[model samples]
Target: MPLLEAHGLIKSFGGLRATDTVDLAVEPGTVHALIGPNGAGKSTLVNLLSGRILPDAGRIVLQGQDISKAPAYRRVQMGIAYTFQITSVFPNMTIEANVELAAMARHKARDAMAQAVDHALETVGLSDRRQQLAGDLAYGHQRLLEIALGIVQKPSLLILDEPTQGLGDAEVQWFVDLLKSLRSETTLLLIEHNMDVVMAVADTITVLQFGRVLASGDPESIQSNAAVQSAYLGG
Candidate 1:
């Protein structure tokens, strides 16, 4: 079974439908990219999957358990972690402290939390800045720290929303490298606009349009899909 599945998800706002019976599956140990034009309901789907917004209809299955009605925190506890498009970190806290707190929430023992924190910091290349206040870090480092905080909990599924939104070319490349290094550790559900990064790193791609799946395939197939190109890629 896939690691995550959304079956017939539907959500509407008054006369408009934000998610129109969307069905998606994310396999374990693969980087799955969800891409579409703006207002295609990508964010709505992410919110539904992350449990920030309860679905009006349909079920969400994570590792065989239904989590459609679960709260956001419960979803996290169930091994789903999300990083928003905007940076989210305790700016006043030290980098290590921020990571340590995330670890503590998931781990009981102090030693275990410390180990997880160190591992996360090192994984995101923030070990050297562990003692620096988060607000003091550069913009790229702040983004990395947000990711570090999410991974410190060792979630089975990590959902990243526009992770490279504001990054420059070099920083985006660095972030892509960082994501590549994480492929083996967990399954990723990425909502990204950068086609270069998506084509480079995605194991599989699913295109959404009008809040529904337009197509799904490997990078090559997605790139060649004439409908997809016309809808979102501006063919």
Candidate 2:
């Protein structure tokens, strides 16, 4: 079964329909990317999935359970972790403490929290900087911390909004490798503007145009799709 499914999701802002009759399916343990031009409703669709905003109509199913009306916290409990486009780390907190907070939420026991925090930091290559304050880290490292916060939740589906928005070329490449490494552990649903990152890591790519699905398929097909090329890829 697919890990998550959105059936005819519809959301509107004032007179503008941000998402219109959208349907999406994400299989387990794959990197699924949502790509589109600005004002294409990618963020709006993500908000609907993350429960930040409720859909005007339609249903969101996660792991065979309907989560369309479920509150954000309830979705978290059901194993959905969301990372924002902007960094959300606690500035004053140590790197370990930052991730520990997320771990504590999911893991009530002391030992489990320890293991989770340790593993998360290790996975993100922040084990060596566990004592550093979050605010002191560079922008790229801060982005990595945000991802650590997500993985610490041990979510079944992780929704990342523009996870690589502001970073240098080297950092973007590194993030790509990290996503590839993470593919086996959890399903990733991300909104990405960078075509290189999308092509590098995405197992499946969905293109949206004017609040509707234009094309969805593997990377090669999406890259070659005539509609996608004209609408977003500027072919």
Candidate 3:
């Protein structure tokens, strides 16, 4: 069974249906990309999966347990972590402090928390900058720090929303490399606009349009799909 599954998810904001019976399955140890044009409900789906917003109707099953009505904090404790499109780091805090805070939230033992913080910083290549204020680092480094916060707890599933949004070509490449290294360690659900990055990294791709799923398949299949081409790739 897939590690996470969304069954017939439906969320409406008044007359606008932000999610229309969306179904998604995320397999363990794979990268699943959710891609579409703006207003296609990708963000809404992410929110639903992270429990930031409760689904109007449907069920979310993680590890065979229904979590549709779970709160955001509960979801995190259930091994789900999310990194926002916008960097969500404490700018005034030192890099190590930011990671330490995330570690503290996940681990009660002081030694375990310290070890987690150290691993997170080293994994994100920020160990050298541990003592620097987050605001003082380059934008790319700050973004990595945000990712560190998400991964410090070793979540079973990691949801990244537009992780490369503000990155330049070099930084995007770096982020891609980092993501590739993480695939074996955690399941990834990525909501991304950069088609190149998505195509490069995603094992499966799901396309959405007008709050509904248009197509879902492997990268090659999704690339060749006529509906996906017209709806998202502007073919």
Candidate 4:
């Protein structure tokens, strides 16, 4: 079975349906990209998956278990990690401290927290800057720190929302490489506006339009899909 599955997911806000019966499957150790226009319900779907918001209907199953009614912390304990589009680090804390907090939350043991912090810094090649204050780092570093916190426990599934949003060309490339490396170890569900990066990294691509699935296929097919081109990759 796929590591993550969303079947007939539906979420509505009063009269507006942000997510309308969306179904998706993500395999283990693969890069899956979800792409669409500005109001295409990407973030809304992610919120539903991470338990920030409950779906109005449908089931989300992770590893043969139903997580549709699970709380956010319970979802985390079930090995789902989510990072927001905006950077979310403890501004006043050191980068190491920020990671330590996440480690503690995930692991409970002091030794595990230290190991998690060390591994997190090492994974992002930020070991040298662990002592720096989170707010003092550059925007890219701040974003990396946020990722570190989310993955310190090595969750089976990682969800990243627009991870390269405000980055420059070089930083964008760095994130692409970082994500590529991560795919070998953990399943990644990426919501990104950067089509180039998405095409380069994703094994499968799913397109959304008006909160519904427009198309889903391997990277090659998605690139050639006429409807997808017209809806998202404007000619």
User: What overall lDDT, based on C-alpha atoms, would model 2 receive against the true structure?
Assistant: 0.91
Cα error of candidate 4 at position 69, Å: 0.3
How well is each residue in 66-115 modelled by candidate 4, as lDDT tens digits?
99999988988889999988777889999888888777657877887788
Clashing pairs in 4: none
lDDT of 3 by residue, 1-235 (tens): 9999999999999999999999999999999999999999999999999998999999999999999999988888889999887778998999999898887656778888888888888888999999999999998898899889988988999999999988899999988998998898899999989989998899999999999999999999999999988877989
The regions of model 2 sitting more than 4 angstroms off are none
Per-prediction TM-score:
0.97, 0.97, 0.98, 0.98
Global lDDT of each model? 0.91, 0.91, 0.92, 0.90
Q: Write the per-residue lDDT of candidate 2 for residues 117-171, one digit (tens) a residue.
A: 8888998899999999999999999999999999998889889898888899999
- Expressed as tens digits, the lDDT of each residue in 1-235 for candidate 1 is 9999999999998888889999999999999999999989999999999998999999999999999999998888889988888777889999998888777657778887888898899999999999999999999889999899889888899999998888899999988998899898988999999999998899999999988999999999999999999998998
Off by over 4 Å in 3: none
Candidate achieving higher TM-score, 1 or 3? 3
Compute the lDDT of residue 103 as modeled in candidate 2. Answer: 77
Q: What is the lDDT of candidate 1?
A: 0.91
User: What is candidate 4's TM-score against the reference?
Assistant: 0.98
**Which pairs of residues collide in candidate 1?**
none
TM-score of 3: 0.98
Give the distance in Å from residue 7's predicted Cα in candidate 2 to where it truly belongs.
0.4
